[model samples]
Structures are given as structure tokens and as C-alpha cells.
Target: MPKIEEAQPKYLQIAHHIRDQILRGDLRPGDEVPSERQLASSWKVSRPTAARSLEALSHQGLVEKRQGSGTYVRSLEVNRRARELYGRAKQTGKIYTPGEYAVITSAGWLEAPDYVAEALGLAVGARAVHRRRVTNNDSGPITLSTSWFGPEVGERAPKLRDPDRIREGTLMYVESVTGRQGSYAEDRMCARSSTDDEAADLDLAPGAAVLIVHHVVYDLQDRPLEFAEATYPPERWAFEQGYPIV
Candidate 1:
């Protein structure tokens, strides 16, 4: 548990307290956090101040506010690895972090799907190195992704066709062999009802809401290297991004 730092803002103190509880497993998904009234009474702060504290937690994606009920810890955790894979490219050579499972279900050359073609700037019917993978967090399977690498990437790194987890992760291996490091990436995300196959893969009920993420990775030369579509059960994963508004 985090001690309330006297110098820190009151809202930060509260946010840290809640965040620590979640991290330490004291609070589980769907667990109700203390209500603002309870917090105000306990912390001796105004109700507005307590509400602000919860709002801070909401902004951090640690809690969700229900319509009738008070705030609760989110069922999903923010996927820091997903963001760090590209965000820290310049500072670190690492691609994936530990504590996750990656299983390659399929990998081989395949005709690019329409969306993959568009994202990778490949012509329709172009053959690309395709890889299907399932990723699991501590809770369980969280993401199913299909990635397509452009010919430039495939020709440079043939091992991408291997049907196994790349020990150092794809980006790290690609950079080591191709020297085309992922300098940055663009992502689009949306939520929609899961298909039967998707539902089964994610162990969710049919028509349950799922999050989809599309990513395009670019090298330092601004050349497209890979395009991918990743699906996640909303209750198992959360996404976050931070960038300067240039």
C-alpha cells in the first residue's frame, strides 16, 4: 500500500491508494471501491474532493463509474506492453515485456486481406508473410492477432514464418536481422460485437463486446514494415496512449 505523501495532491494520494490496492491484488475486478461519501468521511475531505479523486482513477483507467452503482475497479488492466512496444523504440531495443504468453497458431505466406493490404500499402492479392497469434495475460487469453509483414520485411527476416513465439519478440528479431527497427507506429481502435469464432477464441458469450486494434508499424525510413489486427475481450484488456499534441 502506498502511504499518503503529505506533499502530493489529495486526489493523487487517493488515486495512488486505489491503484496500489489493485496492483497488490487487494482489489479484484468488479470490486466496488469506496463511495465518494465514504471516502470523504474517512479522509475528512469534502465530497467534491473525494469525487475528484475517483475521477482521477477513472482517467487512469483503474475504475469505471456505473450509472446507479458507485465506481468499481475495472475488469481489465491497461496493457502497458502494447504501448511500450513502439513508444520506447528509440530508447530501448526490447519489443515485448515478460509475464505474457504468445502462441503462434499459424504462420506462412498468404494473400493479404483487404484491410491488411490497405494498411501495409500492398496491392490487392499481394502475398505477405502472415502470422496468427494468441496472447494471454495473467488472467487468461486476452488478444488474438493476425499480422502481415510486407515483402521487404519477409525477405529480410525469414524466421517470421516460424510457428513459434519469437523468444525476443518479432520486432527485436526483425531489427536484429533486417536493421529496419520499428521507429513508430499508428493504431486505430474500436469496440464491436464479437463474432462466433471470436467469442469462442476469447471465451466470451456470442455478441459480447470486444475491442479491435489495428496497428501499422513504420521503420526509421518511414517504410511500412507490418500491419496487424488484434482483438481483445474488453473485460480482459484496456488500451492507453500518451503523446504530445504537435
Candidate 2:
């Protein structure tokens, strides 16, 4: 075989080399890649050139650079892929990916905020079951989720008021109690800076941008069942949905 001529930029070439290592399992997620100085020494390149290579990978979201710490491969892509297959995972009552866990940090009746009330079609100041949860893996927090259920549904499903992982998950429990299936969901997506509480919960720096998804779920009768807001660190999660054209 003739030696392949490489035409890509030096930094890109280095990025590709490191990327291959990750793909081949040589450098697993959360594993640190060579430091810029190490790369510069090994590749006989300037430190800036090595830095560019790592920066390129970071931009691709394949790795993350921690302040005062070196770059480490990101678990985001793998986690996202697993989540993408959640429709299949749901059948087994296993909603999360391997090594991941979700906890209901708090659950109780709370006065609905304007936004939550509007989403769930409840009156302002109405009491609603509010459930707060955080999902995480060894890589740290993945998402912080808060769900509100209208009194009609909330009171019916007493389990929703408890602070624990719903063993059968919430949707199934809703179907069981209401004798109705979730017929549709409306989602609104936006990007916003982390709130102080959100920053602390997610281990993100203040003002770091996060992806927010607000969900309104309805039953077959077209009655709103729940309103939920899920906040994700941009690098750790991506949202995807598909539907057939009517």
C-alpha cells in the first residue's frame, strides 16, 4: 500500500489521532488525554499547536478541559446514544443508561408558579404535586428535572408525592390510575444561564449556559396531565425528537 498523503491541518491530525484512541477504547470516557506539553514533546510541535489540537476536540464535545486540570474524554456522546434508545429501554422499566441513577430529591404539594400553572392548565396559586429530581452518572450531574402535576392527577396518584425513584416510572403509574394513556406531549426548548440553585445542583459555574426543555403532557382525552422542566448542561445532553407529518 502506498503511504497515504495527509492533507489535513496538523492540529486536526492530532485531534483525529486522539479521537481514534477514544473510539478504540484505549482512552475511555473520563480518562485524561495527554496534556498539551506532553503532546508537544511527543509530536515535536509547539505548545500552541498542541493546545489547538485539544481545543478542536473540545469544540467537538469529545473532550472537556477543566481549569487547572487536564482535558478528559467526555461521556456525553455515549450517554446521548443510550438515551436515544430509551423508547426500547422503557419496556424493561429501566429508563437510565448503565451506571446512571436518578433520585427524587423532593416531592410535595406546592403552589404552582405562573409558568407551571399555565402549562398544566391550573389556576395561578393552585396546589400541585411538585417533584424535583437530579440524574447523574460517574461523570457528574446530567440533568435537573422538576415536574408538576395538577391536583386532579396529583391527588389520585399518592405515590407522586413521595421522595423516591418511582419504581415503575411515572408514565405507567399515570396510565394505571387514570385508565388513559399519554396521547401527546408538547415541548419548548430554550437556552439560559444557570440559576444559583441550578448551578450548585449541576456543579456548573454561575452563568454557564444550559439547555432547558419544558414539557406539557396530555392524555388521550386531551387533558393536561403534567408539566415538567428539565435543565441540562449543554455538553452533557442533547435533545432529539421525530414525528410523522400528518
Candidate 3:
């Protein structure tokens, strides 16, 4: 058998093909899209290629993938429900107010990564305090935060560096020192199978859920001051972002 060669990016081809179907009304709004395996067989491509195609479609707002359920074409009639999950991850279980300070501490070993170095204008391998805290809400089990800070600040404010101290707001302290506040927050959310480490952190059952989140808080100057790799348990938290759904 000759190896299947990709004349075009498999996902793009699949997306264009499916899009054509939609445009032609063959795959109407509210239509049930083919499953990954089905798409693979139909296109004679691998499952991964088919999966990517579906994901591309979803990103383009052409389809929606429900957890554990199959993908479906979105209705052009009404918008998909979007909710900005406010952080309830404090013992007080309240929205964070400006000037409120949250203690930072960690559960495991913490070290700054290269990305942090670049963002914070620090030398690579320069010491930075890192912390991972298990944040909780009134309902319980908020997302886990792996936060980092430059050595100057973290050394001066140990509580700000400790992840276990896990208070209500750290952004306040951030503002106080930097003399600035975050103007825009950038989040890159992605759906993925939960790994063992992620499962334990998010308190999820094995192989039973998708983890979604990418939180980047930038200062008024548009410099990335705080970067959080937040992991949410499936169905526990819904992310809200201003994505053009056209």
C-alpha cells in the first residue's frame, strides 16, 4: 500500500470540505457531524488528522464539541452559551476587590521557567520564587495556580511567594509594588485529556475529562506580569473570552 501523502494540510482540507457541506446546506445547522473514527474512514486518513480537522472546525465556530458527546454543527440562530467564571477561589468565597491581598504558598517544588524569565526581564536561570496553590471556592475545589515572581519581590514578601498561604488576592500586592494594574488579561484555553498530575490537582477521575484554560494577566504597559497555568476540573469551571464567533 502506498503511504497516504497529504496534498494539503489534512485538517484544512477537512475543514474546507465540511465547510463546503455547510455552505451547500448538505450539513445544515444543528446537523450531527461525523465522529473522529467515522471521518478517518471516510477520508482514509488517520484518526489524529480527523480529530485535528474537527478541532479546527470548532475553533472556526463551525461546530461545537460537547464533553463525552459527539460534535455538532452550531445553530446560526442563537449564540453558544458563554459565561465568565468569576474566581470564587477563596475562603471568603467572594469576588476579589482591589487592595485585597492574597497570601501565596506552594505544595510542591517551584522553579521559574524560561518564559517567566523573558516576561519578567530576568536573566535565564536567575532565581525566582515559584508557588503552586490549591485555590478553593465556597463550592470547593477552585483551579490550581502555579505562579511565579522575580526574586526581588518574592524575597521581600515571603507570603506573596508562598503558595500554601493561599489567600484572597495577590494582584493587589502586585499593583502596589509595580505601581500598576493589569489592563488586559490574555487567556489561551485548550481542551486536552487529563494527565495523572493534572487529574490529581483538579480532583478529576482518570481518563474521564478534558482540561481547559490558559490565563495570562498583563500589566497596563502591556507587559506580561503574571502568568498562571490554571487547571480546572471538567464541568467545574467555564471560561469566558471575547472570541469573534463569526
Candidate 4:
């Protein structure tokens, strides 16, 4: 398998680093970014590479370049889109968003719940690997996510059963171990009251309005490889997307 860094262009790697810093609040809005010369020197890359990194960030609306000045972090207050999140994960080989991290609250084999069983095409009460996590950023917990995998995936990737973060993200690691490349995904979302457990993990009052997203990833052969459910506080989080309707 190719190293994660080797799979991404050098410029994108630099851009991701800066983007992470900004999202983590290490580089706040309006802060002047390092010059191309400085970045090239620091990263041991060409000036053009450094320039492209900044340009990429600018195109994403995460930074602004001022004439005669330099690139600076932009002030952004926008909804987090699921598509963007997945794209970033695919690019960076990381499931956690920039500046966000997760704590694996639980990981082990469990009887697949009805919904999970249906999603994974397993019989009800069938054995599966279940991993629960709470993702947080600087403010506080942002989401509570639970992922279910078929037993064979657990057998192939033992790390899924460990109560530890998967550095390459679960699906990516599974692909690496089982040679099942993810081809597409399906997502279903709803707005509803948070359950007791979800409320506790998200630090919200029970019955608070929350957004629930169910995601299923399929391998190249169109077999479901992972089923995930994520809960978010509607007031603090949202999924957005834009497209031209012609």
C-alpha cells in the first residue's frame, strides 16, 4: 500500500496542514499566513508548490489573498457538509475533521441491532463489530457516531475491535486489510429528539432536537462494508450542499 502522504500531492499535503491549523484555531481568522518563501523553506518544497497550497485554500473559501499583502485565514460561519467531510477523509485518510478528534467510547463484538443488521444485510442478532465514538472540537462534543461492521471485517481487521482510534479511518483501514475498496456511499438523514445516550454523549438535554444521519458505504462489488449512524445537535451543526440545477 502506498503511504498516505505519497498518495496526495505535496501541495495538498501542505494545504491540509494549514487547513488543520486554521480549523484548530491555531491560526485564527485574519492571521497572516506564512509567505511562499517561508512555507517552501519550511516544507522543503518549491515556491510554486507553496503558492498552489495557498491557492487551493483560497478556492475553498477558507482563506483570502490581499494584493501587496499575503494570504490570511478567512472568517467563516458555515454549515458542515457531509460531502465535504467525506471528501476530506478520502483525501487525508482521516475520518476526523480538521481540528476535530474522537474518543472511542466502546469497541467490541455485539449482536447486530435490527437496523444495523438490515443495513449490513445480516440477520437480526448476528454478531458484528460495533464501535462507538464521540467527536469533539475546541468548543465541545459535536457528534456521537456509532459504526457497525460485519464479523468478517472484524476478523480481517482486528483493530476494529480495539478501543482505540483508527488513524487511517475505519473504512480506509478495512480496505487496506481486506482489499475491498469503497466505491460509493448512501446517506439518510432525519431530524428528531436525541435519545438518552446520545444526549449524554453530546452534552445536551434529553429530547433536544438533533440531526441523525445514517451512512452506508459499499465496496466495489456493491456490498455494504460499513454502516454508521451519527447524531449532531441541530443548532450547532448542519449538512449543506450546492449544485447547479439546469
lDDT (C-alpha, whole model) for all candidates:
0.75, 0.75, 0.59, 0.80
Question: lDDT tens digits, residues 34-138, model 4?
Answer: 889988888888999989989988987789999998889887643343444555567666655556788999999999989999999998889999999887877
lDDT of 4 at 227: 95
RMSD of each: 8.3, 11.6, 14.6, 6.8
lDDT digits (tens) for residues 1-246 of candidate 2: 112225656676787677655543356789999999998888777899899989988977789999998899987443232223224335456556456778788999999999999888888889999989888877788778898898988878888998977766676677789776877787788899999999989899998998888888788889888788888886644534222244
The residue-by-residue lDDT of candidate 3 on 1-246, one tens digit each, is: 123446667667777667545433356567889899988998888999999989988986779998898898875421111112222222233333222233243533245688767766778877776666554533445455566666665655556654445343565556666576667776667777877866776567876466555466677788766666666666542423222233
Q: How high a TM-score does candidate 1 get? A: 0.65
Q: How far is candidate 2 from the true structure (C-alpha RMSD, Å)?
A: 11.6
Q: What is the TM-score of each candidate against the true structure?
A: 0.65, 0.65, 0.50, 0.70
lDDT of 1 by residue, 1-246 (tens): 334566667766776677655543356678999999988888877889889989988987889999998899986565433444443333344444345577888998988888888888889999899888887766777678888898888888888998977766677678889888778888888889999988887778889998888988888989888788888877554534222243
Which run of 10 residues does model 2 get worst, by summed lDDT? Answer: 79-88
Worst 10 residues of 1 by lDDT: 237-246
